[model samples]
Target: MTNMMIYNELTAICGENNVFIDEPMSHHTLTKIGGKADVFVTPQTYEQVADVVRLNANYHLPFMLLGNGSNMIVKDGGVRGLVMYMSHLSSVRVEGTQLTAQGGAGIIHAAQIALEHSLTGLEFACGIPGSVGGAMVMNAGAYGGEVKDVIDHVKAVTPTGDLVILNKEDLALDYRTSIIGKKHYIVLEAVFKLEKGDAAEIKEKMADLTYRRESKQPLEYPSVGSVFKRPPGYFAGKLIQDSGLQGKGVGGAEVSTKHAGFIVNKNNATAADYIATIDMVRETVKQTFGVELELEAKIVGEDLTETAD
Candidate 1:
């Protein structure tokens, strides 16, 4: 099938206004550094999302799902095939102690809703910058709390566009990984089982966590949150700081002076620059500390060199 045919089909599924060709990924990602996507579609409803996915499967075209884009970096050459932006699906509701959020809903917003309902479990997620779906994929955690602790179940679409409900046990959520990504499941919604607490206490806890995050993280500059995962027996930030790599970087991407764990876009930086800086940090840390640093943030798309070819 031709590109025009694919565009028309997608437009039929998600409306003409929701579909775009050669959309800039930099405008969507948190790092503000990426190339364009071949095609982008924003499906407003669950049925539309499933239809788009089914169409991609039928066409044998590559498909990628994007949530808040908080912990990801896309390469300069951009992504091929279809990119589904899920922001339109965002919705949150509270019933008693259960808080249910759509996949595209901001995790921070979910925490705020929890606070409003005097729920306590989501206080730790008040500072997380990703969407609920993204958070569920990585089992996002902070300050000794993780999404697995509160998630009751998840509704996800299989790669073939069939929807299924996965209980907490089925999720198999670990430190920063989950079965969802491994199985290529698209999260539709999540039910969080929270406990009732005092509204004042929940608010205070969120405030404290927000303060700590602002004070410690380099939030002024655009970044993909923490770059590397914590190695066994040591924190990644401490290792980088101790290795004298705090102020070093490649291109406009610099290891944050405020937080050694983050590589920030201090100026106009390309995805290539950001990736190179990540490589530099990993190599230096491995050489200095003899520990292999694993990536916590995800890197996607293609490089400029590849696109040129």
Candidate 2:
């Protein structure tokens, strides 16, 4: 089938307004640097999401799932197939001591709900900028807490378009990674088991974490949070700082002066600029300390240089 046929089919499943062609990836990401996606669709319901997946599978079309777009980088040549945004599926509710949240719900909202219910466990997530599904896929955590520590189960749609529920163990969650990250599973919802606590204490803890994040992170510019994973026994930021790489850049992308961990779009940066800056940082760090740095962000789409040739 041609791209138009796929677009028509998607429009039929989701309303015409929910489907877009040649959508700019920059508009969807936190870094505000990317090319375009050939197709973009937002499904209002879980069934609609599953149906899209099924249709894509049937057509042998390549598709990618996106959450809050916090930790993603789309290349300059753009994504070839469909990019499904789950933002429309956001919903959150509480059941006793458990918080059940839809995949598209902002992860911080779960912490807010926990605060409302005087739940103690989710205070650590009060400042994470990603969606619940993204958090589950990456085992996102902060201030000594991780998603795996609280998540009881996760519901997702497999690549084959089957909806399946996975317990905590089945997720195979680790530091900044999970089985979902490795597989073609689209997270639908997550259930977190929390404990009742004093609302005042929970609020205080959340406030402190929020303050710390604001004070330390370079939130003034566009960035995908931390760029590199913490290398064992060493911090990525500290290494960059010590290497005198802070305030350095490639094109419009710069190593944040306020926080060495972040690569910000200080000027009008392209995805290629960000990639180049990242390469520079990794190479410099490797040359200086002999430590290989690994990216924490998910980079997708095509390389413009390769495509141009």
The numbered model that scores best in TM-score is 1
User: What TM-score does structure 2 among the candidates reach?
Assistant: 0.98
Clashing pairs in 1: none
lDDT of each: 0.94, 0.93
> Candidate 2, residue 218: CA error in Å?
0.2
> 206-260 in candidate 1: lDDT tens per residue?
9999999999999999999988888989999999999899889989999999999
Residue pairs in candidate 2 whose N, alpha carbon or C atoms collide under 3 angstroms: none
C-alpha TM-scores of all predictions: 0.99, 0.98
In candidate 2, position 165 carries an lDDT of 95
Give one digit per residue, the lDDT tens place, for model 2 in 60-172: 88788989999998899988888999999889999899999999999999899999999889999999999999999899999999999899999999998899999999999
